[model samples]
Target chain A: MRQPIAQGRTQKLDSKRHASAQEILDAAATAFSERGYAATSIDDVADVLGCTKGRIYHYFRTKGDLFIGIHLQALEWALEAVGPTAERADLGPEEKLREMVHRHAMHLMNRASYMGPAQYQIEMNLASEGRNKDEQMARILKMRRQFEAYYATVVEEGIAAGAFRGTDANILVKAVLGTINWMHVWFRPGGPQDSTVERERTAAELAEFAVRGVVA
Target chain B: MRQPIAQGRTQKLDSKRHASAQEILDAAATAFSERGYAATSIDDVADVLGCTKGRIYHYFRTKGDLFIGIHLQALEWALEAVGPTAERADLGPEEKLREMVHRHAMHLMNRASYMGPAQYQIEMNLASEGRNKDEQMARILKMRRQFEAYYATVVEEGIAAGAFRGTDANILVKAVLGTINWMHVWFRPGGPQDSTVERERTAAELAEFAVRGVVA
Candidate 1:
């Protein structure tokens, strides 16, 4: 934010601070994605931005704050990507679910650096302590549940529409989302032939395959 | 070990040394899975085993060494579970893949503590350094490739038999394995309802779903 910005700050100053916070988050996400949460530090995040740790501390009070910010933003990006498709009234249930999975797969890959840290950090540290982190983690967890809800809603619609297999909806949703969540394991950003067409094809094909799994 | 005793003594204490190493790995794995590699320490692993640090260092030289040991053991267990089905001559390509996936999923959940750390550590630090680590890393990499090759062979056969969707085998294999690999992300072992019946059902259902995606 230049979050938690104090009360006397002007609107224009707040915007500049917000941009700085965004910049720090971007750098922190990369560091966390590469080294993971336990290994990454505020200094490393600062180094990623070619700035001193003070610049990071100017917006983030601690490493956990940066992580919380990254997790929040990652979920927000994911919700933005798949939310509209999940709610589209014109599409049938199967079509809607397929599009949601497709957008999610694409989002996971396209913004992988952003999502990578969130995936690694959130899973292991649900019980992490500290007052600010507790609140932030709760918000992050709620947002994550909302993201899962989007998928759950579409999967339920498909089942009720008689297009999806009559299996446990929780299991079905997790299995479908697994195809999207496991991308960071094998994704390498600096391939010699990392073409957009290849990436898009892979995402689309994966979406199709995932949907076919639950199709009755 | 013929085995090397924990503290670098290369002795003929085969069975006991092996047993102790196994126990240490079991304990270390639980710690690593729960806390992640960077957050976990040798002390934490020792605490899990209810032993002192000396006991841990006696079998393995360092935490990295312990991680390497657990990873090798996990892959060994995985290969044991699925390797036979993948090579069985009586089964068709689709049945073979289904069985392999089933066994792998079951193994992952059954030996979750063993496999969870492997999933997290191997994916992040493929390029981790050290002489012992470098050599061990290569063997681990080779075993992983062998695991993938099992799926690749069955998938190619499925495609040739007109039993599987004729998509790229690499992407297909990764997607299918993703269903198995994502278990560590969501699996919670201490639930009151964590019965064998439920675990078997999940593994079976997930295998069915995964294989369905590839079925033509």
Candidate 2:
């Protein structure tokens, strides 16, 4: 009976620690999005969580570790949002494209915490690091290629199915992704329109343009 | 006779200073492009120039000032290449578009030193800084908007003359600019094929795609 109680306590403690780490990640994402990666510090993240830097250090070994972790989490969120939609075998090419576009735009506008930082890191930080920065960057680039490859597959399949024209799949994918990603540079949170509505409209327009551009 | 000698001496001095400043800016652009705005330092720029940090400080008041100067010079190079093409009223929309596309691609592929770093600063580092960063960003944004407006006018004229379709000029401009700007992210120097052939092919393909997309 005593052994069972000790095991239960340990499991509970482990779950609590996991939850704390997630909480810290959430706080870090918000801070990074608002303040940027360079301007933000571990202490700022801790302060936002009403915790101490020690707690962050307990979960993340270093500031770079925390940043890389945040980058990975954000990439995961983006992949989860669009990956499954693009991979659905039952949907026709056009339908799949529309759904993917909708989900991607919505994710960028609504989940700015994740997508915003991902964009910042990719567009800004990746090229700025030195030789010592290769390991972290290599991991990030691998994940990025995976993400881009998923889109490229969808584009190629669409063209093969006669849904899209015979333009270069690589270039078409880059164009589409560029339009989608560039939104982060210009998107404002609370301007004149509802964020969701604006994103939906923009996504629909871009999807229509891309589909028409590639259609037979 | 004294006045003539004094003028000659001043001209020689000015020419030497101009050459030195140009060399420093070139080195600074490479360092900032490779290491990024925040990660790069005056010492690094000086080392690249085979000089000391004091020499860089003599030319640039601060790192920020140097970055801003490099940014402006890069914009000037791009404008010099593409601006004149956009201003020609005699050419048809398709022809004009073709010229713009060709020149823009050539500029990017050849002048990667200036254009690459300029792109990095505009897309990433501008947002990474604080409120003080806004002035520089605003200048960049303004120039970008002007460039877009130039394309929009061409698009509108093309549509009016029955050479193009009446798509949303704003969206079309964004698509074109986005595609062009994204080249820096993936383009490499002497990686695979001849740069000129690759750029020409890309420009032709993109122009064909854009024309088809916008035609009624």
Q: For model 1, which pairs clash?
A: B6-B58, B6-B59, B7-B58
In model 2, the Cα lDDT at residue B95 comes to 84
Cα error, candidate 1, residue B179 (Å)? 1.1
**Per-residue alpha-carbon lDDT of candidate 2 for residues A1-216, written as tens digits (9 for 90 to 100):** 112111121245567776777788789888877766766778899999998998788776666666666777777778888899877899887778767766777777777776776764554555553456577677777878888887888888888988887868877777667666766655656757666666687677666655655666
Error of 1 at A30 (Å): 1.1
lDDT at position B129, candidate 1 = 39
What's the true lDDT of residue B83 in model 1? Answer: 94
Q: What's the TM-score of each model vs. the native?
A: 0.93, 0.82
The per-prediction tally of clashing pairs is: 3, 1
Choose the strongest candidate by TM-score. Answer: 1
lDDT of 2 at B79: 78
- Residue-by-residue lDDT tens digits, candidate 1, B170-213: 78988898888898888778776798999988988898889998
Q: Which pairs in model 2 have colliding backbones?
A: A165-A214
DockQ of candidate 1 is: 0.57
Model 1 off-target regions past 4 Å? A1-13, A126-132, B1-13, B123-132
Model 2 bad stretches (over 4 Å): A1-19, A44-52, A120-139, B1-13, B120-141, B158-167
